[model samples]
Structures are given as structure tokens and as C-alpha cells.
Target chain A: EDKVVQSPLSLVVHEGDTVTLNCSYEVTNFRSLLWYKQEKKAPTFLFMLTSSGIEKKSGRLSSILDKKELFSILNITATQTGDSAVYLCAVGKSNTGKLIFGQGTTLQVKP
Target chain B: DVKVTQSSRYLVKRTGEKVFLECVQDMDHENMFWYRQDPGLGLRLIYFSYDVKMKEKGDIPEGYSVSREKKERFSLILESASTNQTSMYLCASSPTVSEQYFGPGTRLTVT
Candidate 1:
């Protein structure tokens, strides 16, 4: 079965701390991997990585994919209380619009 | 900006009752998806539609049905709600087979 696994199911960090979350997948015909942040109501898009080695970044968040290892990682630097939320990772299959997601890492950023 | 909206934020229904969760997107996306999120289980795909009236079952589609009568709307139906079906139902839309935009989600409680 196509599955995505995320490590450190939960993380507690202080403000300004840096945290790295991991995601690994076993799927048929891997295409792309995506990250999302869920705060209150919905989950917002973070990044989508299709190629390996290259990294994608926004403000304080960055992510990279490793196709050879069948995994990906999302790094958040300078964490704040606002960054306390569940981070989700998903893998998409080639030619399929469907996505398989991991359990997510619930991050708690203390002030 | 792409906007996906769910009809409800929280809903309470009794077992054996029929339930409907509606999702609408403003970006005129070609794909729509329905997923259930649970603690430890992550997000499990229930169903998806690539185009209007074209539906495909995902990993878990038992006891569930979907409708996509128009381009912007997708509906998930529970013919007979059960306690196991209580979960956070998420709706998402995508332009192609890539990045997806999600809605606020609907928390369904079956009693």
C-alpha cells in the first residue's frame, strides 16, 4: 500500500528554536511531495518538492526532498508561538491527483 | 487566491442517519478531493473527482459516496453514519494534479 510516514509525531520547542520534521513515503510511481501547516481551521500550503536535492523555502520555513531515500524533510527556523501547529506531509503519485498524507507532527512552540 | 470552503465547521449527527458535507472552490479547479483526518491515522482519502461527474474511490471509500454536479462543488455523503465515521472531514481542490488548496474542514460527530 502507498503510505507516508512522518517522524516525531509531536515536538515542543521554545521561541527562536529551529526544528526539523521528517517524512518518508512508500508509494507507486512517486511524483511530488507537499507540506502543509494546520493552525485553527484549515491547513495552508507550504511547499511542493518534485526534484531531489533542491530546496524550497519561505520566510522561516524550508523543505527538501530525497527521492533516492524515499523521504523528505521540513525545517522551520526561528520558531514562534504562531508556528505552533500540526505540520503535514503528503506524497502524490504520478498521473494521479490523489495524495497520501502522513499522521503529521504536532508542534508546540512555547513563548 | 484559491479558496475552498466547507459548508460546516462542526456537525453532530446520530448513527444510522444520513449526512452531507459540502465543499465549494472559487478557483474553478479541475479536481476535488475528500479526506478524513484522525489522530494517529493522519489523513485518509475517501474519494476524489477529476472532473464534473467523474468520481474515483480512494484508499477508503466504504459507506461513503460523492457527488460533483458542477465544476466548483463537491459533496461527500454518508448513507448511514456510524461511530467509526466520526472524524474531521477535509475538502481540497487542485488545478491539475499538483498543489492543492484546502478548506477549513468539517468536524463530524456521530452519536
Candidate 2:
């Protein structure tokens, strides 16, 4: 069965702290891995990683995938209280394009 | 910009009542998905549509049914609403299986 697992189900950090969220997946014919941030309502797309070793960055957020290890990590630097949200990881399969999501990692940035 | 819209931000339905949740995408994406988000469970796929008049069961489709009469609209039906079914329902659209744009979720409460 295809599954996605995220580590440190919840985390608390002070402002300006750097936190790393981990995601590992086991899927047949993996195509891509995606990261999303949910603040209160819907999740917003963060990054989509298809190749290993290549990092995708946006502002203070960056993510990378390691296909050989079947895992990915998202790094957030200079966190602010506004950055408190749940980070989700989803793995897409080649056959169905359907995504299997991991239980999100909730980050609470204290001021 | 891609916009996915849900019918309501919050809804209240009585137990055993029929419930409907509507989603519409403006980007003309080929795939639309319905997922239920819970506190611990990140996002569980309920149903998805690949094209007009085409639908498929997702991971958690036992208590949900979906309709995609047109390319831009997808509706989720809960035949009989139950207290346990109360959750945050999210709708998403994607051009392919890569990056998905999500709508502001609908929070449903069954009482």
C-alpha cells in the first residue's frame, strides 16, 4: 500500500528559528512530491519536487526530495508567528496522478 | 491565477439529512478532488473526477459520492449525514497530477 508519513507531528519554535519538516513515502512509480501550507482554511501550494537532489526555494521556505531514500524535507528559516500552520506532504503516483497525503506537521512559531 | 471555490465556508446539517457540497474551478483543470481534513489525519481523498461525467473512488469513499456533470464543477454528496461525518471538506483542482490548487474549505457540522 502506498503511504506517506511525516515526522514530528507537532513542533514549537521561537521567532527566527529554523525548522525542518520531514516526509517519507512509499508509492509505486512515484512521480512527484508536493508540499502545502495550511494556515486556517485551505492549503496553499508550496513546492513540487520531481527530481532528487534539486532544491526548490521560495522566500524563506525551501524543499528537497530524495527519491532513492523515499523521503523529502522542507526547511523554513526566519520563522515568524505568521508562519504558524500545518505543513502537508503529498506523493503523486505515475499511474493515477492521485495524491496520497501525509498527516501534516503542525508548527507553532512563538513570538 | 487558478481559483477553486467552494459553495460555503460553513454549513450545518442534521443527522440523516442529505448534504451537498459544491466546488468549482476556474482554470479548467482536468482533475478535481474532494478530501476530508481532520485534526490528526491530514487529508484523506474521498473522490476525484478526471473529466466531465467521469468520477472515481478515492481512499475514503465509503460514505461519500461525487458528481462531475461539467468540467468546472464537482459536487460531493453525503447520502445521510452523521455526526461522525462532520469535518472540513476541501476541494482541489490540478492540471495534471503535479501541483494542485485548493479552495477555501467548507466546514460542515452535523448535529
Q: Could you estimate the TM-score for every candidate?
A: 0.98, 0.98
Please give the CA lDDT of all the candidate structures. 0.95, 0.94
CAPRI-style docking class of model 1 based on DockQ: high
lDDT score, residue A90, model 2? 95
lDDT by residue for model 2 over A57-99, one digit each (tens)? 9999999999999999999999999999999999998967589
| DockQ for all models | 0.87, 0.84
lDDT of 1 by residue, B22-83 (tens): 99999989999999999999889999999999999998999999999999999999999999
Query: What are the iRMS values of all candidates?
Result: 0.7, 1.0
When candidate 2 is compared with the true two-chain complex, its DockQ is 0.84
Instruction: Mark the regions of model 1 whose C-alpha exceeds 4 Å error after superposition.
Output: none
lDDT of 1 at B68: 95
Candidate 1: C-alpha RMSD to true structure equals: 0.8
